[model samples]
Target: MMTDALTLLRTRKSPKVFDLAAPGPSPTELDQILAIASRVPDHGKLAPWRFIVFEGDGRARAGEIIAGVFVNDNPEADADRVAIERNRLMHAPLVVAVVSRADAHAKVPEWEQTLSGGAAATLVVLAAHALGYAATWLTQWYSYDPRVRAGLGLGEGERIIGFVHVGTLARPQEDRPRPPLADIVTRF
Candidate 1:
């Protein structure tokens, strides 16, 4: 069972786009997934990650806000691009924004806490896969934009680690080429 689980982890890939037909997980299921995602390594019990759920009309609201930010940031941006960006939020039935909160008081370094947040995000993807859902972790330009951060109500010390879009796979993905382990791995 452990080997099978490991194999699943190895095979998991982020889906680029999801089906609109994909159903959102129930509140109980979401809570369970969040619980699993929260178990990532934390050196000082300073849980450094937070989640914001965007569903229903909230998704539309997010899209509008993001589009508005884009227009403000790039006056030359075309309406089509803004529309496309606005439509991105409608791709999935549910989206979860993962934020990393840097800890200032812990003996564990801030970098470690940030790493914990990253681990938590990966755990969220894995948990979604285990629950038979397709997910993608994305961080586009808006992720780093101060306006976007303010729209999300994030604090000064918080950063958008990732935005996880979860839903059903629209179709089976063809196998893509992967770099050989030898190319990237170095055994000291």
Candidate 2:
């Protein structure tokens, strides 16, 4: 079991979000994934993050907001571009927006708080993979757009760290090349 867990971590890879299909995690499975995702190293116990789940009709609503913002910002955008934005979240059975709410705290720096949020997002992907699902963590153009941000209900100092798209992998993916350990590692 220990070796299996290690192997899973070692070989984990995210498929393209577009390649993801339906039959996502059930409500209970999602609850478990979220619970596992929340267990991250948080200094001062400042859980400076929250999750916004987009599933079923919720995905369509979120996509519409994104598409609207894209068109508003880029009036010359073609129909294809607009449609892509509109269906961005539709490909995945579930998309969880990890919002970082790091703020000024005397006990914890804002950077550390933000890192904790990133850890949570990473865990979301890992947990989903462990449960036999494909997951991709992404932050597209909409994640930075002011109008889209406001439309998604983000408050001051809140940022979208990632949108974890989860579903079944439509096809197998080849392993990409990894950087040499000697080039990246050094013992100080």
Candidate 3:
């Protein structure tokens, strides 16, 4: 069992793109995934992360809002560039926006809360992979843009931790070589 778990962990990779797959997890399945993702090591019961699911027309609406913000923010922005930014959300059938919301009164530091949010996003990606879907966690320029945040209705203290895209694999992704373990670890 341990070996099987380790093998699964080792084989997981972030897919860059996905194919059109109907019957992606239903609402119940997504709830299960989010429930598992919520098991990250959070210092307090202050669930610092929230997931925003965007599908179908919602994706297009989000894209339009983002594009509008881009144009409003930069009057000189290229039209094609703006269009590309708007279309980003249309790439996947499902997109989960993971938001980090720090607690002001908690004993845990804000940094820890941020870490917890990141961990939750990672778990969501893994859960998608376990469900036989390709998943990628990304935070592009839009994630940090104030206009985008406003459009998403994120509070002042909240920030996007990641945008997880999930669907069937469009094509097999080639494995990139990894750094040696010795180079990354040092046992005292």
Candidate 4:
């Protein structure tokens, strides 16, 4: 069991967002994924993160919001560029936007809460991989755009940690090179 877990962890890889195809996690699986993703460390018991799921027509709506923001920001952008922004979420069958709602807390620092949000997003990827799906966590320009944020109904205190794109891989992805432990690790 230990070896199996290790192997799953070692073999997990993030494919390019465009390489992710259709047939994402079913409704039940999505519920399981979100539940697993939420099981992260939270100091002060403050769950400072929430998820925004985009599927089917929702993805297109999000894309329109993104494209609108992009066009407003860059008037020189051509149709193709606008279309690319418009279809940003169409590549993946499902997208889960992890919003960090870190706020002022007497006992818990905002930084800790933010880290917990990041952990939640990371777990989303891991959970998808464990369930035989490909996922890539991304945060493009739209994530930080004020107009896009407003269109997406993000509150002033809330910020997007990432957009976890989950789907089936069109083809296998090769593992990228990792830094050697000797080069990075050190004894205290």
Query: What's the lDDT of the predicted structure labeled candidate 4?
Result: 0.94
Please list the Cα RMSD from the true structure of every candidate, rounded to 1 decimal place.
1.6, 0.8, 1.8, 0.7
lDDT of 1 by residue, 1-188 (tens): 99979977987887776443368677887887789989999998999889988888888998998998888878899889989878767898888888999778648899999999999889888888888887889898888888888887899878999888888888886657889999999999
Steric clashes per prediction:
0, 0, 0, 0
User: In model 4, which residue pairs have backbone atoms overlapping below 3 Å?
Assistant: none
**Candidate 4 segments whose C-alpha is farther than 4 A from its true place:** none
Candidate that beats the other on TM-score, 1 or 3, i.e. the better one? 1
Q: List pairs with backbone clashes in candidate 2.
A: none
Candidate 4 lDDT for residue 115: 99
Write the number of the candidate with greater TM-score, choosing between 2 and 3. Answer: 2
Q: Which scores greater on TM-score, model 3 or model 4?
A: 4
TM-score of each: 0.93, 0.98, 0.92, 0.98
Off by over 4 Å in 2: none
Q: What TM-score would you give candidate 2 relative to the actual structure? A: 0.98
Model 3 stretches with alpha carbons more than 4 Å out: 18-23
Mind giving the per-residue lDDT tens digits that candidate 3 earns over 1-188? 99977877898998674453444667887888889899999887889889999888988999998888878878898888888878877888888999999877549898898999999999998888878877888898899997788888898878999898877787788788999999999998
Q: Each model's C-alpha lDDT? A: 0.84, 0.93, 0.85, 0.94
Clash pairs, model 1 backbone: none
Tens digits of per-residue lDDT, candidate 4, 5-67, equal: 898899888899989998999999999999998899999888999999999999999999999
Q: How far is candidate 2 from the true structure (C-alpha RMSD, Å)?
A: 0.8
- Determine the backbone clash count of candidate 1: 0
Worst 10 residues of 4 by lDDT: 141-150
